[model samples]
Target: MKKLGITLLVATLFVSCSLSKVEKSARKTVDGNWQLNSVTYDEKGVFNTHLLNDVTATCFENSQWFFRSNNSTGTYNILDSDCSTGVRNFRWAANEIGKDSGVFDFTLKFTDDKKKDIEKNTGYRMNLKYLDDNHMQITQTIQFEGKPFNINMNFTRTTL
Candidate 1:
């Protein structure tokens, strides 16, 4: 009976570690500042949309972003004078879908500066399509006209 109890405890602890191989790799590579170079759709056409349930899609272009892998928290600044000009804080995670698969289930939860959740039970999930030291791409697929439409947000690492 004693051995069984110890075995169960060990199993629980192993499962609770949580971070997968890909997630750890992604977090390390994503730590730093980045510039949102563009927002594009997989299909060639103009479509109006909002990103991360916030401002218009156009507002994300050329925005500055910062990610802290240590705490999984980040901030983005919308610099367009014509649009909302402010910093938005968010908590994010890169969850690996399979064992060392290089694919991740990315989730973002908007928060206040104090790191309090802005909305209860509400957040966004996207796919971490690609990531490297200098570049990263995230895609959110939504239903448009009963078909899947992909919204891609591209980012490039920046200094300072």
Candidate 2:
């Protein structure tokens, strides 16, 4: 019984370390500047909606983003003349759901420039659906009329 207990402990430790490494590698890939190229949905039709409970979906298009994986912090700016333009800071994390699964539970929280959390009890959780050196996608699912609605935010890596 003691040997079995020790074996389980060792296994758990190994998994924990492995997951940490996986998450770090994924975050490294996301470090840099990106552009929110477009916003799409899973279903069809003209559905006007707000994203992140703060801005309309159209307002996010072409937004500029900067990420610092080393510190788990980032900022995005809305550039459209028709929308409010400013820098919004946030802390983000990419957590691998499985070993080498390439799927992650990405989370973002609003913060101040000093990295202090601004939304004390609210944050956004989304799926890191796809990621690569040049392109990435995040999906946020919300309920609409008692059904799941997916909001897909596509991004492209950029410089400057």
Candidate 3:
């Protein structure tokens, strides 16, 4: 009876662990180029608006590098998505194009790009809202210079 109980316990632990991890999967299968749909403040005393649309950005782990741009040369990366955190881990070559004045002065993009390994491991809770089949609103809330800001990006996929 003791041996049987131990075997059953081991089997149960394995199944439970696997089951829990499955639910931890990121909310979306984020493995492609997505546009900067819309970024909103969603907070009081905050001013925000749509800056760009259908920005070209590619997310491919197997590619030499992922690329993101606004119809011109913009940002790219060979990114790994934690379908668990929706955080895209970039390998190399990421850029923020265009000039815009927001509540945060577009600083989040730069800060996220230069994060260290220890910091990158702790993923942020990404809030991305899907509109229709190919449209999405990506909102990244982060702290820059010891102040919190939310950048709302709106985008639609580009058609070839």
The lDDT leader among the candidates is: 1
lDDT of each: 0.92, 0.91, 0.37
Q: TM-score of each candidate?
A: 0.92, 0.87, 0.35
Q: Could you tell me the lDDT of residue 45 within candidate 1?
A: 85
lDDT of 2 at 157: 97
Indicate which candidate wins on TM-score. 1
- lDDT tens per residue, model 2, 1-160: 9999999999999886654666887798899999999999999988888888778889999999998998899999999989988889999989988667878999999999899999799999999999888999999999999999999999999997
Candidate 1 — what's its lDDT?
Answer: 0.92
lDDT ranking of the models: 1, 2, 3
Residue 39 alpha-carbon offset, candidate 2, angstroms = 0.2
- Kindly indicate the candidate among 2 and 3 with the higher lDDT: 2
Worst 10 residues of 3 by lDDT: 101-110
Candidate 2 C-alpha error for residue 38, in Å: 0.4
Error of 1 at 143 (Å): 0.9
TM-score, candidate 2, is 0.87
**All candidates: CA RMSD in angstroms?**
1.9, 3.9, 13.8
